[model samples]
Target: MELVDLTTTPAEALPLTAFKAHLRLGSGFADDSLQDDLLAGYLRATLAAIEARTGKVLFERVLQWRLSRWAEAGHQPLPVAPVTAITSVALRNAEGGVSEVAVALYGLERDTHRPRLFAKGATLPAITHDGEAVVSMTAGFGPSWDDIPADLQQAVLLLAAHYYEHRSETNGAVRAMPFGVVSLLESYRNIRVLGARS
Candidate 1:
């Protein structure tokens, strides 16, 4: 199985100003914007880490997931959430032939944690032998930073600030997420059942 991010979060969508405020960095200075780029990088890294730990997308973007076989015939659980829509599904043969699946054949089951692509009938279209299925989807809370849940927004700022403070640390020790950030992200995490991601 492979998952690819099809779009990047726009710079304007990031909470740069808010993060600066959180860090209490000086303003109205000649070199005020000098650290902007570095700060942005930290924010992006923090968002990615939080999203990976929680199995959630912090910003709205398109994603493509490819799999050799369906987890289940009637419905296949998506790898990430909260999935807003399923854009398309296609099957690609080993010989490079592609066939688009009809939208009428399946529908998106929107859920905060475990969204699924469910067949409208008995099962989803079958892929040829030695083929793979590609599912394109849009996932995230929303496009703007304000659209994120308040707790998550706070978590991002807190984690980014931590990263900014420790930017020069070369200790090489593994750093765990702050307790507060972990608590904030707890509810958003996907619960695995019986050793399987739900």
Candidate 2:
């Protein structure tokens, strides 16, 4: 199965000013405007890194996930957390024709950490063509950065600050995260299983 992001959060929705304040930059500094842009870049990078690390979308975004088949015959776990809704599901034929799956056939098994697509009946629809079943949905904690939990918000700021502080470093011994950041994100990280779910 492959998960593709259909749309990402806009730049304006990121906590740019918050990050600047966290960095202790004065609001009226000469480089303040430039700093805002720089902070945006860092925040974007850090937000992606955090989402990649945690499997939790901090802000709402549309995602398209492709799958060869359903898991456990009746349900398939979503790759990200806090799924707000499943927009649609489609099956593509061998001739490249796509057909939509009815909304009444399936629904979301909602959870902040591991949402899943649960078939309403005994079985899920069969895809005639391989690698063509696609599930489109929106997933995240909230619609904006302010909707994110305080700990995650802090984690983003700290990690962005770390990235900013070491922007010029070329050392090969860089750690993935500082102790504090790691501690802050530990509870949010997704623990992937080595094999298929039982």
Candidate 3:
């Protein structure tokens, strides 16, 4: 299974000013704008880390997912949560041909934790041979920083500040989430249920 982000949150939509305040950086400095870019980078990295840890997308963005086969005949659990819409579904047959599944045939089951794709009738189309199936959808709580839940927004801010302050001691390239971050994100994490898909 492969899932890729087709679109990402706009840089402008980030809470640059708020992050600056969190960092206690004064706006009077000539390089303040430049610092905004740096802060934005930290926020972006922190958001990515939080999302990776929690399996939740904090901001709304388009994502494309590819799977070899359906988890179930009628209902396919989406890899991500808070899916807003299913843009399209495509099937690649064994013969190396691709076709778009009719939108009316299936619909998105938008759940906060375990969103899924459910067939409208009988069952979803089956792959007869070696092939791939693709599902594209929009997922996330909201489109902007303000759209995110208050706790998550606070988490991002706290984590970004931590990253900004610890840049000298830690490797910025490594996405090592701190315990405080994990604690903040713990409540938002999705708990996978193990059982037969019935």
Compare the candidates by TM-score and give the number of the best one.
Answer: 1
lDDT of 3 by residue, 4-107 (tens): 99998899889999888877888887777977678889989988888887889889999999888888899999887889999999999888899999999999
Cα-lDDT of candidate 3: 0.85
The lDDT per prediction is 0.92, 0.86, 0.85
Which pairs, if any, clash in model 3? none
Q: Could you estimate the TM-score for every candidate?
A: 0.95, 0.92, 0.91
Q: Model 2, which residues run further than 4 Å from truth?
A: 129-131, 173-175, 192-198
Give the worst 10-residue stretch by lDDT in candidate 1. Answer: 167-176
Cα deviation in Å at residue 163, candidate 1?
A: 0.8
Best by lDDT: 1
lDDT of 2 by residue, 1-198 (tens): 888888978888988888888988888767678766778888889988889888999999999998887777798888888899999999987788889999999999987678899889987788784547899998998888879999999999999999998888889424478888889989987676888352
Candidate 3, residue 157: CA error in Å?
0.8
Candidate closer to the true structure by TM-score (higher is better), 2 or 3 = 2
Q: Native-vs-model 1 lDDT? A: 0.92
Candidate 3 least-lDDT 10 residues: 170-179
